[model samples]
Target: MKRTIDFILAAAGLLVLALPVCIIYVLVRWKLGSPAFFRQTRPGLHGKPFELVKFRSMTDEVHKLDSERITPFGQFLRSTSLDEIPQLWNVLKGDMSLIGPRPLLMSYLPLYTPEQMRRHNVRPGISGWAQVNGRCAVSWEEKFRLDIWYVDNQSFWLDVKIFFLTIKKVLIRQNVVGVDVNGIPFTGTSAESSSGK
Candidate 1:
């Protein structure tokens, strides 16, 4: 039932947003150059790997700082979350859900504790409980806590609530890029104490 809802809504969303997505793609190409889409492997449901797609908001300039590689236009895409529009296709392709814990880098898979690994029980999402609550602004520990809470409590109604909250957060542009993009990576035990795991 949830999968049905995810597919229906994702397909509809992709259709409705098609023009805007195209426009964004063109703009990204003009600003960031060729290969306007960013593709990377991320852990999906059950910690399986899948290619997560987004607009390429950063430049390919090597030997530069992350801040330097990120152009102004890229910053705008990240702030408005326009970069994530491509993930609707991921949802349509059954690699993701319309609402679930946001997928993290595949490299982080081994760093997750047994409890934290439970987040992969459902399909990953473009937006989620952690996203609406604080997104990158929160500590890794706090984000994991929210993710686990959603894992335990997820339902159709809860997904609906998160959907709207995500819209509100994005419109308000709150907590977007509030944390350092190059902050230290997560370790398995880093957040374990907070969750009492």
Candidate 2:
């Protein structure tokens, strides 16, 4: 039933937003260059791997990290969340849900504790409990806790709430920049961090 809602809403969203998406695509290409989309392997349902796509917001400057390569237009996309519009296609393709835990990198798979692994019990999403609550502004531990909570308590109304909250967050551009501007990667499990690994 949830998947049905995801599919229907995603399809409708794509249709309604098509023109805006195209404009963003052209703007990203014009401002950022080729590869208008950014693609990365992300863990999906039950730890399955899928290529998650978003608008390319950073330049292909190998010498500089992602934060440094991010242009003003890129920041605009991030602030407006135009980059995430492409993921509606991922949702339509059955690789994601409109409301669930946001997928993380594949490398983080091994780092998850048994409890944390429960997040993968359902499909990943473009926005989730963690996103509405604090997004990148929250600590990894808190985010994982929220993810697990949503896994345990997921319901239709809950999803509806999250959907609206995501809109509010995007409109206000709150907590859009979760990590540091240096593009520091997410550190691993707390234990690993404690061990300096």
Candidate 3:
């Protein structure tokens, strides 16, 4: 049922937003140059590897930090979430779901404790409970807690609610500031103790 919904919605979304996506693609190429898309391997269901794609929002400056590498156009893309549009293709490709735990970097996989690892029990998503809840504003522990809560309590209706809430968050650009990079470093055990979990 969930897969069905993800497929249908992602297909329709990609179709409806095709022109806008093209424009964004051209603009990203103009601004960022060379590769207009960012592709990185992320852990999917059961910790499987998959290529997660998004619009390239920063320059290819290996020495520079994300803060320094990101341009005004890149920040606009991040704030409006236009950069995330490509993930719809990942959903259509069965690499992700429309609603589930948001996939993080593969490097984070080893950092997850047994409980945190449960987040991968379901497929990764373009948006999820943690996204609508507080996103970068929340602590990593809180985000994982929300992710796990959604893992346990996910239902069709809950997904619907989260879907709408995600729209609201995007419209308001909630917690979008400083989102060029992941908010806090999750040091596995240290985060657990700091959050008193």
Candidate 4:
């Protein structure tokens, strides 16, 4: 039932935004040059590996870490939530949902303790409870708690709430971080920094 709604909404969104997506692609290719798509291996349901597609919202360079890799245009895409538009494909492929725990890097798999690993119990999402709450401004632990909480209590209405909250947050540009040319800045970096890089 949730998948049905996700399919309908994601397909509709992709169709409606096709032209804008193409314009972004052309701009990215013209500015960043080639490989207009950024592909990464992210864990899906049950920790399965899948290629997550996103617009190339960063500079094209080898060994450029994320913190130092974001571009001005990429920052715009991210802040406006336009960069994520490509993930509708992931939704269509069933690699993710319209709402669920947001997928993270495959390398972070080992970083999770047994409890934290519970986040992968369901399909990943384009937006979720954590996103509508505080986004990057929230603590890592809080984010995990929200993710786990969503796992414990997700439903059609909850997903609907999250979807609407996401739209409001995006339109108001609330609680999201600006990208630095070199990286995606961590909002609670001092806390994270005390632990380590």
Q: What is candidate 2's lDDT per residue for 1-197, written digit by digit as tens?
A: 98888899999999999999999999988998999999989889999999999998899998996669999999888888888889999999999999899888787788778888999999998888988887656677777889899999999999999989988888887643223212445556777653446
> Per-residue lDDT of 109-178 in model 3, one digit per residue for the tens?
8888788899999999888888888777677777888999999999999999988888887798764222
For model 1, what is the C-alpha lDDT against the true structure?
A: 0.83
Best by lDDT: 3
Cα-based TM-score, every candidate: 0.92, 0.91, 0.92, 0.86
**Which predicted model would earn the best TM-score?**
3
- The full ranking of all candidates by lDDT, starting with the best, is 3, 2, 1, 4
Show model 2 residue runs off by greater than 4 Å.
175-184, 191-197
The C-alpha lDDT values of all candidates are: 0.83, 0.84, 0.85, 0.80
**Cα misplacement distance, residue 166 of candidate 2 (Å):** 0.6
Distance (Å) between predicted and true CA of 2, model 3? 0.7
lDDT value for model 4: 0.80
- For model 4, residues 62-161, the per-residue Cα lDDT tens digits are 6987647778888778788887889999998899998998888787777676667899999999888887877666666667778899999999899989
Model 1 — which ten-residue stretch has the worst lDDT? 174-183
Q: Between prediction 2 and prediction 3, which has the larger lDDT?
A: 3
